[model samples]
Target: MLSDTDLQAIGLTLRLATTTTLILFVVGTPIAWWLARTRSRWKGPIGAVVALPLVLPPTVLGFYLLVAMGPNGPVGQLTQSLGIGLLPFTFWGLVVASVFYSFPFMVQPVQNAFEAMGERPLEAAATLRASPLDRFFTVAVPLSLPGFATAGILTFAHTVGEFGVVLMIGGNIPGVTRVASVQIYDYVEALEYGNAHRLAAVLLVFSFLVLLALYSWRPDLRKT
Candidate 1:
């Protein structure tokens, strides 16, 4: 039996995950493509930066982001200059943090997919007089569907499970920033074990299902 607050937290979690996944797809695709194809010396550094969150503590990342979005911080000053106010403690702030936290989950799989593609298909497309952009759209993306699916699933699931980062920046504001993980934390802190268990169980089952679907999916073998 979920309380109204718990239900709201679930809904907010879904919304946050959905938003973060979509943003990651748009932002990570070109970055992954470049990482897969670039031979530049900067590739290693860029890739390392992209993968930093995987190794860095969430609290550390969240701390920096919190400062960066604070009223006097650079990001905060810039946004204020642009009249958008401070980002921390807002939905958009959560979206930005989630995107950073889940970035590697989205990029790595797609980058691997691109690397596995080899040069043969692109060369074939070249021979057909297909422009670089055309080949990327018509050839590269179609073949990379599996990677995209994996990236999207991983990003969404990771975002849904986020806690430390969201907590550090989002500040538990009910429908605004009180996500399921944070709500569960509050429940436990208040000795409300039943509520905590209910939410935790839902998240556990949801995450398992998402991963199961990702593993079972066979994009290459599917009849399109």
Candidate 2:
């Protein structure tokens, strides 16, 4: 029988990953759209910053986030003044950490898909009386579906596996911040290798299935 604590950790992980992916979709799409189409001088710097999490150590990111979300920090003080506590050590904090850590996963694929599309489809759409918004919704977004799927899956999976950042920001409060990755860490620390293996295998299988779907269906989804 699965312990209640384990079940709670799994549920929280899924919730955190789902919320993080949703936020990434909302936030990353516009940035990716701009990056793909814009010729601005700042594009390189902006892209690099977006991809920072991919290259930077997770502990470094977590350290920065910890400071930023601490009581006296900008984010913390600002939110506290508004009658809302800083979200650190809570579910929302986990979401924020996941989004920040998984940002490149969300952005790069969408950008690639958009770049792959080039300008022809939107140009043709404009010729057919489609407005900018219309062109994006009708033409650009459809062409970018595969990328979005890939990005969403990657972001969710990455978020699920996050450990250092969640530990820094969320502090392992069971049923609140005790996500599966952290739970696995606890099991390993307690020398329960069997439990850790079980959890890790589950995550591995789930990620493999998601990537398989993405890679297999991607070719079929290409624009004609």
Candidate 3:
């Protein structure tokens, strides 16, 4: 049996994951496309930067994000100057952090898909007088559906599982920053093993289902 607080945390976690995944698709698409298609000397460097979070400790990333978004930090100062206030410890702050944390999960799969697509379809479209933009939207995007699906699933799952980064920046404010992982941490810390088990089990089941769906999906069918 889940408590009201547990439900709230679950809702907030879903909201965070959804928002982060959507933003990643919008932001990561072009970046992935470029990484897949470009031959520039900067490609390796840019891809490395995009993949940094995978190797870096979540606490390390979260610490820098906290500092950068603090009232005295550059981002905080800029926001204040713009009359937008600080972003730390807010719902939107969580979104930002989640996006950073889950970026590679979204980008890498899509980039790989693009690379696997080779040059044939684009060339065929070009021969038909289709412009670069047209080919990208009509051909490249449609063919990359599998990658997009994988990216979206991975991003959402990763965001839902976030603990260290969210904890470091979010500060456990119920209905604001108190996500499922944080809530479970609280439950355990208070010796509330039952509640912790309930929430953890829910997360485990949910994550398993998401990955199962992703793996079972047939990308080839999307083409037909």
Candidate 4:
């Protein structure tokens, strides 16, 4: 049976995933919009950078982040000067890592959605005297709801499963950085197979159910 700590880990994982998803939505939406609309040659390089984490080893990414967020690192120094101190091995650090790790997941979907939309709708809106921001909120965003939903689900699920990056940067600080994935690792390391199994099963079922809802709910709207 899963213990109270195990349950807390599950709750923390969900909270972390939720926070990451929300931040990605706010941060990624504009980037994706620009990527879709921009025609500059530099956009390709920028897009590649945004997508690099998808292919890079988690440890490599985590290692770099660990250095960057360490006490003597740039982020740490800036935070320390401001009295915030190094964020590493803290909840905020976990949030930052999860944001970077999950960014591409959120961006790519919204970008694809915008690209598929093309300029037709925007042009049509312009004829109706709509401003760019107005058209985006009134036309583009509503049209991209499905894509956003898919992206949010995938990003949250991916964040929930993160281990290497979180473990390396978060240091398994209980109730702060000890997310479900790290807790599962702790269980396995102590040969607590039953606890690990339960946690793994819970995550599996939860992810599957969310994905099943996203994929199976709309055969008609999918054409968009």
Candidate 5:
């Protein structure tokens, strides 16, 4: 049976994932839109930066983020100047780290969806004198619902499974930053294999169910 601390970890993990996915939905959409539609010279560079986490080791990214958000770092200085204090080892810190770590997961699918949409719909909307924003809200977004769903599901799941980045940025503070994965780690470290197995099984079953539903619900929407 899972203890109260274990339950807290699970709840915290869900909250973090939910918040991260929501942020990604809002922030990533415009980026994906630009990536799919623009022919700007800076596109390649920006895209590469967004995709960096896909290849960069989690610890490496977390290390740099920690440095950047440390007291001596510019981000830390700026936050302090603004009276926001440091970000590391807090729930919001986990949010910031998770956002970066899971960004590409959200953006890539939406970008692909927009690309697959082709130019015809946008062109048609323009022919009707629809402004860019209006057309995006009306035509492009409505048509790309599947893409958004894919992005949301993937981002949520990815954030839930995150360990290294969250551990580095948020530490193992219970209720504050001890998410499900971190909770599982603590169980194993304490030789509490029963607890570890229980927690791990929950995560495993969840991941499997999420993927199964995502894949089976709409096979034609996005390829796995």
Candidate 6:
């Protein structure tokens, strides 16, 4: 019953969420590992930066990012010089914004998993003459599968539901940046409650399923 526009929005949202989750996994891993194992004084500061999005308003964060990626900002200048053009109002812009906005959701769960694992597994792996990288990939990662799942689910869901950040960065260009959330907003603003309801209901069911999967498989991911 959904229109093509609605379907495109949903598909784009999935694409953005998927891209954001993957980037978070790659970027958040080292950060979480360091947070879990490091005794450095910088840990607190770095962790605070990672967790800042949780407390900051999405619009505020997005505004800063927009400014940074705008023509006058350094990011824009660098991108322009590199021929990458401006990032704002683009699909990749949404991905970048989603990554920053959903960072804490990914980090906290994975960091908790890594910390819960302790150093015992890595130490044991080392005793077997495994290299540090090998120990992490073979021992640490395998033991933290639940946490990775938790992080991925949370990140994907959060990105899908994002509004202010995506709106600021990507605008409402259909098939480009008009994701489900923005589409729903457009429906409401135009007094199209029926369409809004349909989209909202879809997201509602999806979110419920994601949470159900998370809790059913790893309730402790919810605890921390």
What TM-score against the true fold does each predicted structure earn? 0.97, 0.95, 0.97, 0.96, 0.96, 0.96
Q: State the displacement of the C-alpha of residue 2, model 2, in Å, after optimal TM-score superposition.
A: 2.8
Compared with the true structure, what per-residue lDDT tens digits does model 2 show for residues 37-121?
9999999999999999999898889989889988988988987898778878888877888889999999999999999989999
Residue pairs in clash, model 4: none
Which residue runs of candidate 5 sit more than 4 Å off their true CA positions? Answer: 220-224
lDDT of each: 0.94, 0.89, 0.93, 0.90, 0.93, 0.92
State which candidate, 1 or 5, has the greater TM-score: 1
* lDDT for each residue of candidate 5 in 1-224, tens digit (9 for 90 to 100): 78999999999999999999999999999999999989999999999999999999998999998999999989889988999999998899899999999999999999999998999999999999999899999999988889898999999999999998987888789999999998998889999999999999999999999999789876775443
Quick one: ranking by lDDT, best first?
1, 3, 5, 6, 4, 2
Candidate 1 Cα errors over 4 Å, as ranges: 219-224
lDDT of 1 by residue, 1-224 (tens): 88899999999999999999999999999999999999999999999999999999999999999999999799999989999999999999999999999999999999998999989999999999999999999999998888899899999999999999999999899999999999999989999899899999999999999988987775543435
Residues 62-94, candidate 6, lDDT per residue (tens digit)?
Answer: 899999999998888999999999999899888
User: lDDT per residue, candidate 3, 175-203, as tens digits?
Assistant: 99999999999999999999999999999
Query: Distance from true position, residue 70, model 2, in Å?
Result: 0.6
Q: Using lDDT, give the best candidate's number.
A: 1
RMSD of each: 1.3, 1.3, 1.3, 1.3, 1.9, 2.2
lDDT of 4: 0.90
